[model samples]
Target: MVSCPFAVSCWNKSFPGSQSIHTQVLEVWLEKMFGKYSDNKYADIVTLCWALWRARNDVVWEKKYSRVNRVIASAKQYLLRWKCAPVTCSSVLFRFVVEEDGAITWVRPTRNSIKVTVDATLFAERREYGLGIVARDADGLLVEAKIKCYSGTVTVEYVEALGIKEALSWIKNKGWQEVKLESDCLAVVQAIRCTVEMQSSFGQVVADCRRELRDSNSISLLFIKRSANVVTHCFARASHRYPDRTFDWSDIPIEFQDCIQMESI
Candidate 1:
């Protein structure tokens, strides 16, 4: 499911409690879903999975986009038309309302403060890595955005640590004292907070990030769900394509516009 771009956003929008478990593997997700909605939910889940798979295949093979909501609605319609067993009170307890704008949307920063969001993506097979850092004001206006690349041996954790360190340096250089440094990687965020430490060489990177963060004034390191950090995720993927490119608020490329627009709402 991780390989399917639509799966993450679909589950997040169509189901409640998705933020905590969307990152789980497919089997675990299915297990949790069924466990939570066991009262005649088997048929519902079966229909949902079939719909999503067919929707994904349509995009992959026919070059057509399929909205997740439409697919889910079709699945439900099919179940009703086929006279499937009715869902019970137990299933009602787990019902989730679909989000209209999808899940990967932006969030505002604290009042009178700056928010710096960073993300990193690794392509292990190619030994390539990319980092994205974006800053926005309290009103959610873009302050700056940067994309960086590294062609060396590194893990995703190390790349995330690097993202924190580099983003801090950029923030410090910009003279933003009261700021929030956010990332989607929970392990790295906890490691930076000194709550946990990696035993591998990546531990040193975390240490360096902590030391760098310690010198910053009024900077808060936070972990956010991936859904709320879509802009950074998009930029991280962009960095792999355009290595070492820097885009200011006015100069950001056209591809970023859609995600930014989605979040602005």
Candidate 2:
């Protein structure tokens, strides 16, 4: 599965060293990946494996083919369903409580602290990427919002890393303290939180993020579900509208008003 051109593209988009992974046995490769990476990415890798296996079976038994995007989407849909499953056991400690609609809502930060959500979106047709950042106070009131666009043909992880780095730099410039930074990119979050050296293509960006975190004892980085990060996700999706690469939120855009209100609710 790793050697297949279609699977390779999906792996490379999510995992940086997937192209160089050389092993005759699939189990051996999985073992190596699990050992080399953080725990947060384990679910994603396993889900992708299942998706690829299902695709292969379809091709073999039903004479059907699945595109890379469909395979990736299938994996994500499965993962989301798994996450939305209700936890009946009272002893289990879960950070998020799945709602009736199975969507996790944005959480407010601790008193006197601010929460910053960041997300990145890729425009493949335009050969560019956009980043969105939104800051809200402990009461969930919007303090500021920003979006930036950069021209490049990079992997999803790379752009995600860039979004995080930009968020940290922006926070540092504002001299914000007691900040709770949130992102849906679990791999990037784990990479920054862990002390182990990152040797991937975005290692430098991760290093910069780590440096920023190390310098600020009051700031903490955590992972949240994409459902809870809808505001920033919307901003990232609408980033192409702002070619100047910066947004002035003195007057909030009409398109973003609903997203901002939803989070507040």
Candidate 3:
């Protein structure tokens, strides 16, 4: 499976080290890997394998080929359906709600809590990254926004971790007790929520975020689709127009007004 170009692409995107495993027996390798994976991770591995097999079958029997993105989406949709099935007990509950148009729209936080969306934009040529954060109240009105640029050529995952760390510090300074932090980076979110000790630099940032959250019981981190996080994305991209560090409490950037308005709808 790893030898196939399509399968390789999907594996690289979903599981980075999947191609590195060398074994003469596939079943033995899978059994060893399963012992190391969490329940959710195990589910993801099996579902993705199923997806790849189905895609291969379609091409062989029906003469129909599925794109890598389509196969990944099918796996995600199937996993989500399985998670959302009726169960008597489940430790984690997914909050993703798909719209009629197949888009995930931003939803307001409950009363007494605020929602903060964060995103990071990488300027690879400049060897720098921009972090943007926007906070909104229960009524969906903007409370504050910030855009900061940092000089570094870090991995996208690291940049995302930095954004969340910055957002948490900003929230702490504001003395906000109840806040929901959202980011478009799923890996970063999962790392922060995972109990496993992270040993890398990116893991250090995620550790800091977890420490910040531990100080406040009401604070939480969540993953959101890029469509639902458009406001923060625009803000991150707009950072190039401003100074290295900028914060806005009242005036919204003209370019970001449209995005904010769209989210408000």
Q: Global lDDT of each model? A: 0.74, 0.80, 0.77
| Model 3 / residue 41 / CA error / Å | 34
**Model 1 lDDT per residue over 138-213, tens place:** 7778888989988988878889989998998898888886888888787787778774656777887888788877
TM-score of 3: 0.60
Candidate 2 CA-lDDT value: 0.80
Q: Whose TM-score is greatest here?
A: 2
**What digit string (tens of lDDT, one per residue) describes model 3 on residues 1-265?**
5567898798778877666666647587677657666676888888988999999999999999867766775675566556645532332564332221112457888898899999999999988889899999888888889889888789999999999999999999999978888888877887887888978998889899989888888777877767677678878887777635555545665555545654775
lDDT ranking, high to low: 2, 3, 1
Alpha-carbon TM-score of each model against the true structure: 0.60, 0.62, 0.60
C-alpha lDDT (0 to 100) for residue 29 of candidate 3: 61
Worst 10 residues of 1 by lDDT: 95-104
Q: List the residue pairs that clash in candidate 2.
A: none
Q: CA RMSD for every model?
A: 13.0, 13.6, 13.0
